[model samples]
Target: MPDTEQLTTTTPNVQTDAPSLPNLEQESWQQLASAADSEADPFKTLVVATCTNTGAGARMVVLRQVDVIRKYLWFHTDARSEKVIQLEAFPTATLLFWDDKQQRQLRLVVETRLHTDDYVADDQWHTLGLGSRKIYLSERKPGSEQPAPYQGFPEQLGENLPTKEESEAGRKNFAVIECRTLSMEYLHLSRKGQTRALFQYEPESKQVWLAP
Candidate 1:
């Protein structure tokens, strides 16, 4: 029988040679920044889950920014989206990240705050490219149905980029969701065994390994 006690790797920035709870947490923060900047990083996109009247709602969003010291995360969304409404009502959410290359999953519990017309959103908006800004220019609110299947953006524009003046309309719909992480749960799967740990940041800081 093949032994389930060894593993090999073909990815970068994944270390299992000396894995520890603190080391794993440190690597997660570093990878968050790398993921945002590097297109090849699998951690660039995360699943954000929010509370809904029915149950739970989840969607994939690009990881835009990371604040390591403050343990904050940032993602952009349309101000009129259902997720925004859900967050405004619940304030607390979970961010789930899975790295297929690393065979690991990181779940973060966070308190969310919306920034629509504030400086935070304004600053981030200025950094966005015209392509990204155009997404917010839809005539109808996000998730709204159309009579004859309307494209999200104006069909007249087609593949052509919108002018700076034309893109200004999107600013009103643009928002930044700032997430302050309260706790992080890390799980790593390996052929030999599995490793799991929990890091608590709120109320008091603590770290403990868990059985996987």
Candidate 2:
């Protein structure tokens, strides 16, 4: 249930503005930007679930970038990333984001493009801090078997990330994904109950507040 503030908005396109639409969009993007800049344990910061060939699915990845005006999102991966392989076979994916503090959930349906070339990959690689770049420097690719359950890198480097030169090995494996968001659904819980809305941005613009 929304606040008793009882503000209503009507947009020509959405058939209703309800003031809350812009409020929701603004707050949503602000929180999204914060999540993108998270400094702690960045893994699974934004999980994108994708269906690979044969109908298997997987999730858990970080959010690398966001273009609010353009409504596009990005994430980094290895050229050997399983998600990349899956996206190659099926370009559709769903991005799921939940913010506990706000009790908000965002679901985005997107079309994905993978870039493995040097120029594009280098652009993303240059932005990665030393700690993150170290993950890509492993001798074996991601998902590789461990001879003895290794720490994903040499023992001496345990919890100690490698230097720039050391991370160079990962440069060759860097991959960037561009996700054009097609639709965005938002859910927020309030004392009243729950408020749900759908914002569609592709093919045509659409917005709807549904009964929950």
Candidate 3:
């Protein structure tokens, strides 16, 4: 059998024939933008990690909005969730994304702000479908204890879609989290080789290949 060649010895931060950082940034935006309808975009559900007094707080959240020009991302959550409290105190977080098929990972550093009683929240809430709104209609606060397992929403509602008037009740608990991305780190893994790069957006915009 012939020995397979290894390509991992390539020097870091060398801008040669590889894809440019701008192209990576644009590709990330396109994936996030189309995630709602494209199952191929693993960014549809990314892991969000935040700082807490005890340690790190992490959870999986759906990607709601993407602003390519401004480098902002948005996701919706319950106003009373533990993460919301943590974010209120820390105001910063890391978003991690992985694409199994592409063998790629994206790490995004971001500054976050909560928008529960603002126009941003209202606009986002308005676009949510009944299925998504039902999550906010929980009778008890999130993470509450129960003798038996709870479905979050009222049992009577079952799987039925809530009426517009009924869904309005959820608006109070709905919250939109606005995230301003400061930097993005990209990594691609392959048996043949690996690629890494960093794209800085805040303070000043710059891109550089990074040591994998």
lDDT of each prediction vs. the true structure?
0.90, 0.78, 0.88
How well does candidate 1 match the true structure in TM-score terms? 0.90
Taking the tens digit of each residue's C-alpha lDDT, what string does model 3 give over 23-63? 87788777777885554678889999999988998999998
User: For model 1, how does the per-residue alpha-carbon lDDT over 26-104 read when each residue is reduced to its tens digit?
Assistant: 9988888788777678888999999998999999999999999899999999999999999999999999999998998
Q: Show pairs that collide, candidate 2.
A: 1-193, 9-17, 9-18, 10-17, 11-17
**Candidate 3: pairs in clash:** none
Q: Tens digits of per-residue lDDT for model 2 on 1-212? A: 87889788885333242357777777677666666777462322877888865776767778887888888888988787677789998999998887676677888999999887767677888899998887777667677776777565556788887888888878877889899989989987767467788889888998888765
In model 2, which runs have C-alpha deviations exceeding 4 angstroms?
A: 1-19, 40-44
Model 2 Cα shift for residue 117 (angstroms):
1.5
Prediction-by-prediction clash tally: 0, 5, 0
Q: List residue ranges in candidate 3 displaced over 4 A.
A: 1-17, 36-40
Which prediction has more favorable TM-score, 2 or 3? Answer: 3
lDDT score, residue 188, model 1? Answer: 87
